[model samples]
Target: MVEVDNATLIAFTVLALLAFVVALIFTGLSVAKKSKLFVNTIGEVSAKYETDITPATYAFGIWNLIFIWQAAWLLYAFGSIWRYADGGPVLMKPDILPIEFYLFWISCCLLYIGWLFLWDREYLFYAFIDLFLLTGCGYAAVAYQSIALNNNMIGLMSKSPVDVTLVYVLVQNGTDLFFSWTTVATLLNLASALANDPLLKRNLSAKSASTISLVILGIMVLSWSLIENTVWFDYFKYVYAWYAVLLWALIAVIVKNYDRTNYNSVFSIVLLCLVVIALVVKVAVYASRIS
Candidate 1:
């Protein structure tokens, strides 16, 4: 086990704080519908790259939920450090996430901030790369959280009901929600990048690229549901939050592409519907088993 020295801890805290400040500033600008660089707001930039797989405007509203949940978790986690330090009384295993988790999160934040800038500047390929890296970082953080939980490094040491709930609710659920959304966003970014970049499109038409990417995302979601129902059943608690956010994205896409006359739209809708059904059934099965 790597020991976290005072200097390392201080560095992590500063990075996290800096990331939080950047996020808040971006959020404020978004809420105000104002951009420092004229005509470079996220919505404005994304509209320029709209592809067949791009979800409807409402789908992006999920950022509100993501930001709120993330903020709540960060506050609780930070407060727990001062409130429960030295094992004062109400101990919480996940009061402070592991060093690996912080490292991954900080990297994700940096990449996300950079991706915004790149996307705003119309650097589609580079923006996609940044989003890809950000998604990978989110996945790594979630993976580490899973490992910590499975190894009895988090929830296992809880001392109170609040601690136990916070362990899984604020920590696990919060991370999963953030990661799942990022995964969807990454797929959207890839489709947009491919559609806009001539070299990346190659022999594929813009519509074809979007359709293929949509199918890929559908298959990915279905595979995850199947795995959670079988292989990961005992290893980790069901990732209900991930599936829920993904379901939201799929529904938004289906609503947007509800054109019966278009083959690409109809085919992609059917594939995504199948994936949604799989997610629903898997969640029902998990609930039944627990009940």
Candidate 2:
């Protein structure tokens, strides 16, 4: 039997608490703002595509209900972790695989769910799985985002263009921004997860956060450029890349100055400038090509 030290146990408890808080905040904000956008966008897309699927047809209303349930479950999981730390029985089996493994599995499930949407046929049963997959992935992402931001290992592994491109391909072909955004959201979540971990509390420095944020921001910029060049005329592609870049940039600024009051104002200005330049150049080139 492996003996877990008191310090290690305490650290895990703190980490769980932090993850719970962060997840709660994110979900609350998402539900408040993004959920409306999601419904509206889906309605618009269906209309544009001339699809018969209505918000009701695709169970959008029910999805919000499921999301609330999932958020409750996540809170319960975190509470269980905290309870187990104080000499209680394990709330969840430590025998369960590492968080990253769970994240990967959730990602695969999300991909599957998105694929189901590609068919003209509606599978109402699959909607349950889709909701489950989103909840799982969102939870895992939040739990791990902090950790990855602090550790730098997960983001490093995700550095390769080929690897990132593969993820992008899956997202594109899946034809669902929900899956793509969730994947990206998880990357951010990993950072949040590590931020609250006890072991990493001391080891996770401001510099590390800044570096991780910068790297992710760079990836977002590169991805935006690629999408702009490849699908310049597609409004959807532009919107996707533009919003993704903005989100990553916001994250970078937040992480880069995690401990500072002044924050990365200079970097934020530079990033905005660059984005404008990139957009202008891409648009000009696209127009020239069309002419």
lDDT of each: 0.71, 0.40
What digit string (tens of lDDT, one per residue) describes model 1 on residues 30-138?
Answer: 4355566434678877787787777889999998888788788777766554564335423233323567877898888878777767777788888878988888898
* Off by more than 4 A, model 1: 1-14, 30-34, 37-39, 85-96, 153-158, 198-203, 284-291
Cα RMSD of all models vs. native, in order, equals: 3.0, 20.0
| Segments of candidate 2 deviating more than 4 angstroms | 1-180, 199-202, 226-241, 244-263
> What residue pairs are clashing in model 1?
none
Worst 10 residues of 2 by lDDT: 49-58
lDDT for model 1: 0.71
Per-residue lDDT over 1-291 for candidate 2, one digit per residue giving the tens place of the 0 to 100 score: 233554454455455445435544544443353554223333343233221101123333433533444444344434444444224423223311134523443454444335234211222224334544664564444334323322433342334224223322332222223334444333333333333234343534433443454456557666857755775334323234344434443544444333333334445455666667776777676678777
lDDT of 2: 0.40
